[model samples]
Target: MDFFDKAGVMAIGSRLRMLSEQLTEEATKIYDLYDVGLKPKWFPVFYLLSHDESKSITQIATEIGHSHPSVSKIVKEMIKEGILSEHKDKIDGRKNNIRLTPKGKEIAIQIEDQYLDVRNAVEEILNQSTYNMWNALQEFEFLLEQKPLLKRVKALKKNREAQHVQIIPYAPKYKTHFKELNEAWITQHFKMEDTDHKSLDHPEDYILDKGGEILVALYNETPVGVCALIKMDHPEYDFELAKMAVAPEAKGKGIGWILGQATLEKAKSLGAKTVYLESNTVLKPAIHLYHKLGFEKVVGYPTPYERCNIQMAKTL
Candidate 1:
């Protein structure tokens, strides 16, 4: 057919808008034929008020899924047309309740037969189609409710950016990123402890020299995440997964997960039987990630950081 028709789902919004306008025009003709003075755009608000009692603008907007300003404008227009009236709420004097006027009630009674006829007509159209349009619309709406288009598009964008992320070995040049990333998150949530300063300030001296391994995740050749596998002396665990941080601006692009999976694989390759980690319950996402990576809660083993309230271990 045309360009928009050829584009199919890519032109869904424009196509749907056009379809809605077409239906509105046809509905207007039907309303005129029945001698009913109702606008298609006003049908949602009008039909709602006709069936229900007085409701505030906010209530109407919420129930009809229309914006507050939209409902307010429609109510004003209907009030001017002598189809609706507003009065102060009895329960809440600060609020106003809107209800159908006498003329609106009479019009509603007059439109009852037209509504039945239109419903049957729409059902006939739907049944004539190969796929029922009404059912498809409802299912598509439910899918959109589950994951809105905004969130879906954002996730796709993040995944595309994450494809540029590369995990590299910690080098002298990445020292600043390693320290800064850890310090930024630590200071934002809790006071930087002496242990934090010791490990972060001298990762090479305190961690690398003691058989620990540090991995840096680079996005577009810039260090954005760092995680260390610190060799532990504990009886139950071999290495402690510590000092993991992603740059604030680089978060939610799957950098942390990339570094995490790489670090775990490296740990497993180093003859490690189990990996340990300490975290607080407040960091829900981090805790969830740790669980997803096969870590389980543990009660024993003390932590040097005061902020750490939970301990976990993963068996390789």
Candidate 2:
């Protein structure tokens, strides 16, 4: 007859809150049974101060994952109850440090056995569950630290927008766009080399005249990315995929992937037997994109650029 019995996953937040209240009530009963004049909520701050007497309010809040206002309220109550004391920090005169009072220390020593019993009872209750809640919580916290929930959501939004972009062949108007985009990216990461200058300054002479092709990506009628496939002079019909760049604001929307795909298709259309690329190890996302496009690493590929430590090629 519990409301949560039918709510299922939709009421997960409520269910967790109800469980927390139930556990707190049980803990309160245990404290009353042992005649310990302490509140269940106050235990976390008190316990931290007991171990580290010189913790500031900010430090306690951070360690316990509680807000400053909430920790401040708990500290105020503890100070009123003579369970905690505060003093100005010697190293930082502006900061106030917290420590357990003499009376609080005495109470902590007296209730050590009771606290152990409480811990054992909680462990026993958790062992009856299908999964370890403590381990799961630790993992959840680690994942949040690695990539926050809001950041993941924003990235998903960017990916959706990126899917709607259109890939188009290079035009006269897009010539400035090609140089600006490539310069913005290159200058942000590394200095532009002579090879970059020659290709970017005159795409027609350096790329088009040499039997190469340039492709541009458009999002909302704005140029967001550009990539070039440069043909080699050898009779083997080899092409180098180079000068790929995406705008900072338009990145992470699959623009790079789209440009890479278009460049590969252009290479194939031009009768290229193999498509090669030179890149640095620092460009992890770019390297991953190349790998996704079936480009495997090769040794001793002659590159005109100084930053070209990684070389990869895909057979057309």
Candidate 3:
């Protein structure tokens, strides 16, 4: 009776192994549908070949975690079947460089599409909270790739019910809630050393004097989000949209998207031909929601911001 191999632990391990094998079989069937290799064993070879025209047998073996002799055998078979071609490496004449032919490249593209389909299939099966895990994982992965100091960690998305979101126009009475919402947003998501309230305030003043309107989203009668639509005097850009924010407490409820839609409808009702917004990219959820709502990417400000900011425009 080994303590390290207790019955309960062993049973759990065995179950996981069986599940892994089942996933592998299912994956093979998917690949077979695309006329590619039934299993992903060939995927590494395809991926390496697609990235570069040629790779040595040793390089392919190292990448795929296989023995050099085993890779040589596979490469030889592929060459015979016209799936791959071998060339003499110029730097080292002794080594053979492996490359995919046109047919092989076509299969590689199909394999890539199949991978995306699998992802979409899984997302469809999960609840919205679980589905948002994909977005969180993508953001964490992107950060890891860009920065050397960060270690990849699982960051599950915070969840809230969409029905819980409350929408309202900006009111002088709720100025305190509006201020707190903006503070909560910048604090929770982005690290702002100092905020220039003057910039936001100046625009709000000008818009309020003219035809600009604001909306604040509330949850439990507490303000959790804000947005505004300003009627522009300039004919070129008729409406300057501003002051979009979602508080940390009310995040992931899809409130921001609701606010965006509200703003768009407000703009349309006011006869605005176009609407525009300025935002930084660190707010990934906001950016994604904006795109999904039919906003297209456009060059706005001349200077590049540290937060990967971009401007979005849409025609009402």
Quick one: ranking by lDDT, best first?
1, 2, 3
Which lDDT value does model 1 have at 113?
Answer: 97
Error of 3 at 222 (Å): 1.9
- List the candidates' TM-scores in order: 0.79, 0.58, 0.46
- Summing lDDT over every window of 10 consecutive residues in candidate 1, give the lowest-scoring window: 1-10
lDDT of each: 0.92, 0.88, 0.71
| Native-referenced Cα lDDT, model 2 | 0.88
Clashing pairs in 1: none
- Whose lDDT is greatest here? 1
Q: Can you write out model 2's per-residue Cα lDDT over 1-316, one digit (the tens) per residue?
A: 2777787765866877888999899989988988887999999998898788679999999999999999999999999999999999999899999999998999789789898998898799789989989888899789989998779878898778976799998998999999999899788778999988999999999998888899999999899999998888644439988889999888778889888988888888877789888888899988999999999998775678888889888888
Of the two candidates 1 and 3, the one with more favorable lDDT, higher being better, is 1
